[model samples]
Target: MNAITKDVEMEQQREDRRVEMAQAKDKEDARERERRWQESHQPRDNLAPRWREVAGRDNWVGMLDPFDPLLRAELIRYGEFAQACYDAFDFDPYSRYCGGCKYSRRSFFQSLDMANAGYEVTRYLYATSNVKLPNFSRRSKRNNAWSDSANWIGYIAVSDDATTVLLGRRDIVVCWRGTVTQLEFIADIVNFNQPIYAEGIPTPDRSVKVAAGFVNLYTDKDTNCRFSKYSARDQLLAEVRRQVLRYAEERGEEVSISITGHSLGGALATLSAYDLAEEREVPVTVYSFAGPRLGNEPFKERFEEILGLKSLRVVNVHDAVPKVPGLIINENVPEFVRRAGAAMPWSYCHVGVKLALDHKRSPFLKDTAEASCFHNLEAYLHLLDG
Candidate 1:
């Protein structure tokens, strides 16, 4: 009888231990989900005041009013036309809108260059070397293997000499695409290459994950995309920030960061700008092309609070993506019509296309591509004559 009682007691104890372990695991998973949710959504505190203040300033609207009504109408119409060209490109990596179309390597490069045409032209006007180049065909390294399914992120280095000495040999253009696992590897690589900066308002707690890109996204949730891969943005940003700091210190240069991306990457860039500003007070600029909305009205307002006007610029080359910050105001409109707003009218409007076309008539395109473009020498010389 004694032996039988002991065996029963041992069995009961084992069952209780199993239940405890399961409960602990459940708690852990719940906490992780909560953390991820916070990361994916924009934080209300960051958006409220600054964004609302800037949008309400009327400075931009006032500037527009000086032009003729016909011009205003044309601007709107031209915006729509430019948008159509982007739509024709068929570059839908994030949204489900381009269901039937597929991206050929040739088409992808062509569309990319066209999209950048305006930038190239602007570079020429400023006498700066055109960073714009035609989308040349390079054999994609397993590009399509990840095409159907695989998370990817790209980083474009913009550390041109114009950026100042503080930023060193970092690539101005960097892009990466991959799943969570791939993101982790990329983050680790960035961490290895760059020194990390942990300074920022309201630092992350141990329970919270710390990253530059995702951290801002998590804060600016309302006006940004809630894609699953977005969670990695912060981690990747943390890595980049670390690198930026290392480069700045090594070169004895003041820290300045600028970020840009298209679509999902654009949304991440916006988040990154806010995070960098909040933490280091470092001057930064974010140029997002066709990024999706991250949050609600409240979040938009808060975004301005955290990221001031100088620190951020979200540009939609037409309404190619859905309604996002500083783009088409009408959210209820159909996606197709809304997207049509992306097109611009001037012959030299598209960034890459304009550059490619301009190259045919003059050596300016080739010179600008090599980064030798700068403010016009003739104009300066003419000023001396006076």
Candidate 2:
């Protein structure tokens, strides 16, 4: 072979080795998860009476420190729902439905072999990708196939009769898909806050604002794509309103909304939870992992104090994501110090309880320099399992 051909062959060999190693890692992860699942056995219990508290009504008081078994189990359960979005997404760019869900909504859980999830997919959520943001799954969209204007972001699932009885209340879940292999979304964040009114979230407080990039994704519309004709925010709100009417208002059932996501999805969860709580009387709670701070001081105040949003953020202390956007001016700064930039758009704050975990303490996870592994959803579940 010529010198150029020889170099190409060597590069192919290295790439093959990397793929092989990644496959091995996947197998090891699966085995580890199976082992952990076998060890942690939480028996099924009728949680109907305490469902609100389980969903964080009292802000998870007395349930986080010792990592209450029921609460931990519920968190894991919700995490799996978020994980389902990633699993069901059609990541193959060559597939005709590249940006849409791989399975029909009716068969979503069944196709994923998650028949035990006990929730039915009510609506598939879609969003028009911002021109500035990187499209992680499909770099180059093919025309006349999947609409370039849209991508399936996640889905909303409601607990069935069996699940509702087991969990103690009718639960409405919104699971926004985050990333595992693709981390381009993180590098693309604009690191600025915009007024919440831009997204049509009716807050009288002028100071309340959110990350410009996240709000754009939640509120942007694409009339060309059938899936995203309405913004993700509108789709979510309409369906939630419908579900509440059919199950709660009409049926006389106790209903609760639990929003869960990891990484970017977590920011959306927090944003949507605030929007929903602002519109209705039902209890709303957020379970997010490795999510970045999404809003400013006034936004946090309105989200938690006024809306009574119950958020449980489970993050690796080592992950860079949770400590960003407002790295210098966030809530951690002394109150007087934060007030220095309270008038600025960059002064952000996290709103809710934090469940911090250290990956270094884990014996299984590799001690890596990159934050993606630490920011991984499976990694969060593994750490939470311990």
Candidate 3:
């Protein structure tokens, strides 16, 4: 009731009000900073006109040296598309859906929390199992297994109308799943060459040979698996043809095919690109990550000079997979030496422009990480971002 006590209480109330206002102002400043950061990082829009350059039609030209922000964003985006295949795949042998996609085509993106991916899954691709089950995939040995004959290899997805408008083309994506470890991938390399024409591939040159292991992976067929009596190659060509007919020819839309993969899947992507684009009018570009040498010198020349494919292969210098299948006799040697070794079973050559990145340069990763860490698709994506 005293005047002095009332005055003290009033001053304390005013001090409390000032403290609260200061805290609120600090919180508002933090939120404003976050908004600005996010706005700066969003990918640039209206890529429709420059999509050809982004797709490497000009061999990526000036865009690659300084590493264009749009190009970097697009590369990471497609790399994530390849990573999506691994995320949506059913890997556990105990589950009945093992060696298959975990979700249907309609709900594939949604199931992976990628509802805003802006691509529609049109078809699911399957391939007869080739590599051993011990290291990579494990098919159920129980009587109630899903399919012992085949595995869900990858998928075919097309950009939606809204995305197409922004991309300047109806982009058809062929993404393949790759093995996690390099040791598992190494087990499947046969190091032998087979003429692609022998397999009824659409190519005029009979001498265009590729690794027998890859050719078998593409051409092999099994009937017991669902929606896959046709070989992976057959399924791919058929589906791409259908998409091109509907979009490019019928609908009068600009279209392009982008094939992506990692490790074994990358090798298959290269093979599929050649088969899909050779002697055809489709504009196909490959975004391969951590892929090995795909084929012989003739095979490379046939696809690039003759068929015209723009391939951008992203690789880590520390990764060992890119150096094999042609260590002794590869494109690095002299012309006469390469010609002399071209007929050998072990001779191999890579296709298209290589975008080499280094793992040591990444500050987040440890310098002593295992070999698998270096070859991981996610790791490749991180490097691409830098």
Candidate 4:
């Protein structure tokens, strides 16, 4: 009987030791998990996060008053600079390449329809070379009517006493293609594995007008559609800064630049904005519509820092181009990705659209501040994330 009692006591002691061991192990695991969580949530050291904090939505109160003196002054400066550049450079609006082609026109209509359907369309156009695409054949000239592709996109206007006037008009819109040495790496990256042309490949796509003014545009195409190697990316950025500075100088204003475009133009605009910030001590603001991803995390972060609160990236839900930058880091970006990556490095803000203004009661201009795509400029200021 005593031996039995001893055995029971020993078994009870063993059970107590096991319980103590389990509790200690659990405590250790909990501590380890908390440490990891703290580390991951910690901020990194760079301009990316700093600019983001500044660019957050709370910083843009009262930005869209239109009558705001400071904002008006900035717009006037941009208008004057654009006007001078338009006057000095002879922009050929009509091109025989992409603009003049039936397929390209169809593409333009398709994009327009998307915009009309409330899908924010971001479109990009690159010249195959300097030469006109659909050369004005003698047959076309013989006919009283030029091919539909011969048309240009929008007007280049100058300011006169606070009013914008079309000083120089073209059959289409023409953007400055920087010198080959300027866009070294970017030219190579964009024009890689593409045919080299001597005459130039500026296509005459019509979407340019549809997404103008509010879009950020970028291009490195010169007389030669081809550019130098990738190492020239920095050089290209420098040239962009020079152009901004030169344009500003011509207008008798400081370096207050506003860049806009859609699709490929959006990508270029984003890149140019970043270059301006890195190469020059200027405050550059970019508004890109339906732009694609230009670089990796570093590039996006740098861009966010340069533009800060002034940068606004507008997107359409079904539009595929804007998905590029968001996808570079995450292989599969969910719709919630925007909210998930809400903690940006720079002052990057996003606006989204449900559809264009084509439906019977389209949501494009409904003025919902909560939805990113809604046209509540005032509301967007509230939602902006620095």
Alpha-carbon lDDT, every model: 0.32, 0.82, 0.82, 0.33
Higher-TM-score candidate among 2 and 4? 2
Output the better candidate (2/4) by lDDT. Answer: 2
- Model 2 misplaced regions, further than 4 Å: 1-43, 135-141, 181-183
Regions more than 4 Å wrong, model 3:
1-43, 130-134
What lDDT tens digits, residue by residue, belong to model 1 across residues 304-330? 543443322223222223232324322
Measured against the true structure, the TM-scores of the candidates, in listed sequence, are 0.34, 0.87, 0.88, 0.35
- lDDT per residue for candidate 4 within 1-386, as digits (tens), equals 99999999999999989999999999999898655333222212232223322222333345443233333223232222222222222233432332222333224323322212111112122322222222211112332333322222211111222111111111011122221111222223332112111112121321111111112122223432222111123334444444444445565443334454444444545555554554455555555444444443333333444235255455444434444333333324443563354334111222311112111134333433333243222212222211
Structural RMSD, model 2: 9.4
lDDT by residue for model 2 (99-187), tens: 67889999998898776678889999988757366544343255566676788899998988887887777889999987554356655
Candidate 4: where is the Cα deviation over 4 Å? 1-252, 306-309, 325-328, 331-386
* Better by lDDT, candidate 3 or 1: 3
Q: lDDT at 343 for candidate 2?
A: 68
Give the Å shift of residue 373 in candidate 3: 0.8
Question: TM-score of the candidate numbered 4?
Answer: 0.35
Cα RMSD (Å) per model? 27.4, 9.4, 4.7, 23.7
By TM-score: ranked, best first = 3, 2, 4, 1
Give the winner by TM-score: 1 or 3: 3
